[model samples]
Target: MKKFFTILGILILVLVFVGTAVFLFNKSKEKPVVYETSSPFITDIIQKTVATGKVIPRKEVNVTSQVSGVVDQLFVDAGDTVAKGDIIAKISLAPNMIALNNAESQLESAKISLSNAERELERQKNLKAQRLVSESEYNKFLLDFELKKERVKSAENNLLLIREGSTLQSDLVSNIIKATSDGMILQIPNKEGAFIVESSTFGSGTTVATLADMNDMIFEGMVDEAEVGKIREGMELLLDIGALDSEPFQAELEYISPKGQQDQGTIKFQIRAAVKLQDQVFLRANYSANADIVLDKREQVLAINEGNLIFEEGAHFVDVETAPQQFERRQVETGLSDGINIEIVSGLVESDKIKQL
Candidate 1:
């Protein structure tokens, strides 16, 4: 009976050891690596570079003050359409006290001189009619009197300009700000009671309002120096506006800066493109956008995943599948790449299966 029990225990220990070995062996074995493969297909490949910037009007006219004064009233606000010569805002003249006092004094002196001249001219006319004075002498007095009267008028107009920033004979009121061009008012930078300086030769002065033609819009952006050389005027651009939800806007390159500007330690070149507006879509000024400038493009060409291409010393190769679960290295001529799919110029057919890295 003892022998029989010992034999049974040994048999149990042997079965436990066999089970542990089988479990470890199965866990150590690796599954076969099935490399996903993609076949070359006909598609459009466009190589482009992205530039960040904003969409704004092609020409922005700043409605500036013509005379220094305090804003009394605003006839238009932001987003209002305006025409040339339309009143944008009214400014109350903040006339200089010294200048006003001088103008008043000058006007009073001119009146006194005109009163004296009128009396002298009356006496001269009477003398000439009675033949008591020569005709030439009367003519001289008349000319002097006329000159005095003109001086009085000139003084009066000067005083009026100083007091009200306008004159009786002038049509343009200096205190009234008007639109310089036909466009929509983009912004009103000043409020009622805000004092602004007039635009003069010495300074640009305060901008009362910003006006722009919304119909003519452009995309102004900066491109990296490395990519600027690949672009030129008349190229096409696809604009992606962050504020709009519709399709990307189309634009044509118009201007490229001759110089580069440094931003955040990287040199960037400025570029401008005229945006082609679509119906029912309105693009506001300064809408942040990203532009995809196409440098090269290929239409309906054989392309494959760019990751499948392997680079050696100076040649490009791809692992083309010859049979199921088999691949061989083959040299391929490449073309435009849109950063994902690359154009397969030669050495590959539409039915060729390429390994995905």
Candidate 2:
């Protein structure tokens, strides 16, 4: 009975050992990898580069003061629409003390001269009446009196101009600021009573208001130096404005800067594009935007996911599925790529299945 029990226990131990070895062997084995497959499709592939920038008016005019003065009255505020020659603001002339004093003194002197000439003319008239003065002498005194009177008038006009920025005989009012072009007022930089310097050849005068034609807008942006070489004038661009929820705006590339500017560690080139407005869409100035410049485009071409392509030895290849769970390497000619999907110029047709990597 003892031998029988021992033999049974040994058999149980052997069975346990065999079961553990079988479980470990099964766990160590690796499962077969099933690669996902995809098929090429006919789609439009647009190769484009992105540029960061803002939307601004193509023609912006700074309404500056023509004479030094303080802003007395503003006719237009920011966002007001104005026509050419529209009054933007009124300035109260702050004439120079020296110039004002000089004008006053000149007027006083001219008045005094006129008074003496009048007295001399009256004496000459009396002498002529008594037949003591000759006709030529009387005529000379009359002319002198008239000349003195004219000098007084001229001095008075000069004083008026210096004090008020205008004269009775002049049509142009230097104290009134007007719009040079038809546009919307973008900003009113100066408040009422703010002092402004006059615009002159020596300096850029104070800008009282900023005006721009909102209808004529442009996309001003910068592109990296690497992609600048691929872009040119007259290309099409789609602008995405961050503030608007509408579709992208259409634009035409108009200007490309001849020089490059360095930002951070990368060089960037400036570019400008004319924006084509759509109905019922209003674009504000300086709206932050991004531009997608179309470099090349292929319509309705056979394309596959760019990740499915295998590039080796300066050539492009793809693994085309021959049967279920089987693939064969095939070479292909490529065209434009939009970074996500690539255009297959010549390769397997639409019916061919491609192995997705």
Go through the candidates in order and give each one's C-alpha lDDT: 0.92, 0.94
Q: Using TM-score, give the best candidate's number.
A: 2
Candidate 1 structure lDDT:
0.92
Model 1 spans with C-alpha error above 4 angstroms: 24-30, 312-315, 319-323, 326-331
After superposing all C-alphas onto the true structure, candidate 2 shows an RMSD in angstroms of 2.2
Model 2 residue runs over 4 Å out of place are: 1-5, 128-137
Per-residue lDDT tens digits of candidate 2, residues 1-357?
999999999999999999999999999999988989998999999999999999999899998988898999999989989999999999999999999999999999999999999999999999999999999999999999999999999999899988987888889888999999999999998999999999999998999999999999999999999999999999999999989999999999999999999999899999999999988888999999999999998999999999999999999999999989899999999888999999998978999998999
Let me know the TM-score candidate 1 reaches against the reference structure. Answer: 0.91
TM-score per model over all chains: 0.91, 0.92
Per-model tally of clashing residue pairs: 0, 0
